[model samples]
Target: MFVGAIEKVDQFTRPIHFIFRYYTGSDIVPGTATLFFVNEEGFAITCRHVARQILYANSIYENYLKFRGELRKFEKDPGFETQRTNLENKYKISAANPIRVLFNFIQCVSAYKAMTIHLHPTQDLAIIQFKEFESVQYQGYAQFLKDSRFAKQGRYLCRLGYPFPEFTNYQYNKVSGDIEWTKEGRSKTPSFPIDGIITRHIGEGSEITGIEMSTPGLRGQSGGPLFDPNGTIYGMQSATRHLHLGFDQVNREVVSDGQRRRVSNYPFLNVGQCVHVDVIKQFLREKKIKFYEQD
Candidate 1:
């Protein structure tokens, strides 16, 4: 039902690809997040969590550099191994802590000198402004639904994002001990669209702030656009909530592959939670960003 709408949304919806590595590991891990253009001036919207990770990437890389510099100072000493261990302990480098984080805006801008991010004080929404860009790579922008009353429950909506990290345009620099984006390997990943009915409305007190969809928002779909069959954006996908169905089976016998087996099953329903279009519009207006709306 939304085949054409998905094509239209794909013009403005872009993936933000990221690569990171833990302090104790040399392997590079790649992931993705979504963002959509709101205007021709290079402004876009994404979840605050995504923006925060972009901002925190600098700190992670800098800390790693500092540790490397400190370790070099003790390389010539007779107790080099001891000093290395001491420094490692001092920096608290571990498997859980990332030593490097890097990201690139995929097909959104040709080139940019810098970018600015404005995070909502209370909402999961955020605004991004690309500065001094040579050209805009995205084809179109989002046209939000004007009247939110049209977004009633039982209406089916589709969300678009890059949930599978199929892109391989990144590598780990073993010599430099850094993870960097490379010119080789595949640079594009396919976008996925999932459709579901509006199950409920989420609110703070009496003011509605979010929409709950019956289907779960897959991983890497955060910050994706939520729209109807007409391609009118209703909200931005922020997160997913898992509801316990209260159907629990312990050590139950079941037939599988022509064999009998005992399995314990605990089921949960995952639902997508999106930031409402009204909240998105208000945030953009407060930031003096230009956007489009349709009746």
Candidate 2:
């Protein structure tokens, strides 16, 4: 059970934050996210879903929205024609593809709709990169797993998150129920263990290319890093269900394209998934992060 770094300032940069959506509007209302550091050089790891919305926007829309059309205008409550920034004129994109005004990170980074990711498609794992690196204290993950030669059966794994906490940062106002809502598959811990077995060898060498020979995963804990008894890096969280959409569900129903009020529940699904450590090693190698390969 890793107690995530609480102090906002990492050795290189600031704490990570996120921008998510949930229980409030006609469409998905945006919400917040959190992240923590694993490297001394400011690099951190976080859930892909936590940053996907913003990334998908920039990667494609940045080019698609370059259209010429009437920009959507806004009014403050009843300030009908008072004033507004013409999104079309201001952002070079239009209704087909408009850029969001703001974005956030849950921890270790910020204002990024897309900069911190080197993601795996099916796995919930996401590798984030920073402009620079830092020298924060690492608990020597390499040694942790080495000590846990044979993963203890029925042992527990735990994770720490900022969900259901107020003032995630010292600069927050009195907000209620500010949650992370990221869906996780399995969990691990530094404080306590979760009940599960090693099952079998998902993979033997420096790759995680095997099936679940171990215990399964849980909800809201995706993208979490895994470990061996010595606490060395092994895997990260990735939660999935039959059909997945983990966020705050809006109680109010809104009519959709067909003109019927659709029902989408605020997700409370109990399941999650994770990416194997081999993928992570490849990511670091690609980024020149000097990764270790187990024998």
Candidate 3:
């Protein structure tokens, strides 16, 4: 069962890493999303934001290609071209979001292509179906809970995903631009679980809008599942709400005017937000996908 869950993730939500290039340096950003089968035919669920990113990335790549064409015309000037090449090497040459799906023990990668994305008309939900691919794997699936009893506040739920890839993929090569995978990179870091209590339910009168979790969901854990102790699906982790704490003043040694200054920084409290699974079911049924439901 454990291996089955891991394999299910391998087929669905892919660990994505992207580098944001700037004139100064490059920043490595890692992300995690939850995806689980709705049926044997491979219909799955995830956050709308995640799907939008895949599409946005494709658009960025196309734009980058066009920009490259414009740059090629400047190659006639040797000095101008040399500086351009230096800039390209210093930053990122391609605006293309090289989202490598960390699957198959991170030995292989798949560049996600958004084929079909049906987003909920009013909710932050998206249903995605990948074009038939060769490396796609299949395994255990998730079942939605139709009973509203499980939606009560104070209920315990757990989520699973690769939350901290920096720790898992410990070493990275700055020069070579590669992940220094420890232990041959074969021992893939399995998705771990984090448990939290439902602090409150939002959108009360009508269909549930969202739910508040006691523990804040990390950046990489978005689109992951929120399920109970028995593994009954409840909601999809959406985002975190950062409530501002009071600001504090800290003395800085240097300032723009070459004088010491006091800098104020505001702290925040992060609370996890989840989209109710009820919304997921409605979206799926509208699409004609079959799944387990007892309502």
Candidate 4:
């Protein structure tokens, strides 16, 4: 039963990693996002901020260590496998190597799936489509996010994701990554979870809103699907933080050089906000995608 439950959450959430091109003092850097596919049609939803492709990001450090190492240097280099195996066996793991996970957000968009991107990055909501795909492994996501008949306020909800920042993946050579992860075909591995209430049924423009979750959510869990006890998507994991309120005023000042400086910021924000399903449905209409449901 416990194993079955894990499979349930795995259907919707995917491990996300994106490649980015960045510029440093001299060299360009490549990066990836911690994201997964929603509604499983190869269409994925992640924090706009998370998926933002920056040309110059100095804030991010550490990643793809195995690929960045001498082993990677020998990726195409002949006769380097022996040396790479030796190094991997010795250090086991390198301190400088960066680790991120990859997962497939299958192409599952179709008619009557009741899935779509509900919100955007600034609003932090995305609609998604969930088309059924045959598989012994997943049994079709119809068992998961597609149904809404079980929707209720106090039902049990589950969240899935690899929230660990100290992530790692072993590789055989430059072109090949971990045996289990790379070509091995692993999908939607659940890392952690917690329980929460719906607070209210928020459809298009419902005045009902509150702190949707009493418990905290993981960082990488930003766009993960939230399912009820009967396995219907109540909402997606949005955000959580201690509410803070402050005032923003332009502290204008003139320097001796006759230059004025000003500062501005948005303040008085509370903790944890969802884009609401009303918005989610809107995106579905715009995208012309349907949701799948199980009887």
Alpha-carbon TM-score of each model against the true structure? 0.92, 0.48, 0.67, 0.48
Report the Cα RMSD per candidate: 2.3, 11.8, 7.4, 13.8
User: Which should have the higher lDDT, number 3 or number 4?
Assistant: 3
Q: In model 1, what are the clashing residue pairs, if there are any? A: none
- By TM-score, highest first, what's the ranking? 1, 3, 2, 4
Ranking by lDDT: 1, 3, 4, 2
lDDT of each: 0.93, 0.41, 0.63, 0.45
- Candidate 4 lDDT score at position 174: 39
> Tens digit of lDDT per residue, candidate 1, span 1-295?
9999999999999999988898767688888999999999999999999999998899877877888899999879999989888887887766798888888899999879989999999999999999999999999899999999999999999999999999898887779766788999999989999999999999999899999999989888899999999899999999999999999999999999999999998999999999999999999999989999978
Q: Report the C-alpha displacement of residue 293, candidate 3, in angstroms.
A: 2.9
RMSD of 2: 11.8
Off by over 4 Å in 3: 1-30, 74-115, 131-136, 166-187, 245-267
Residue 221 deviation, candidate 4, in Å? 0.9
Better candidate by lDDT, 1 or 2: 1
Clash totals, every prediction = 0, 65, 1, 29
Model 1 gets an lDDT of: 0.93
Candidate 4 residues 265-293, lDDT tens each?
Answer: 55653333344444444455566755454
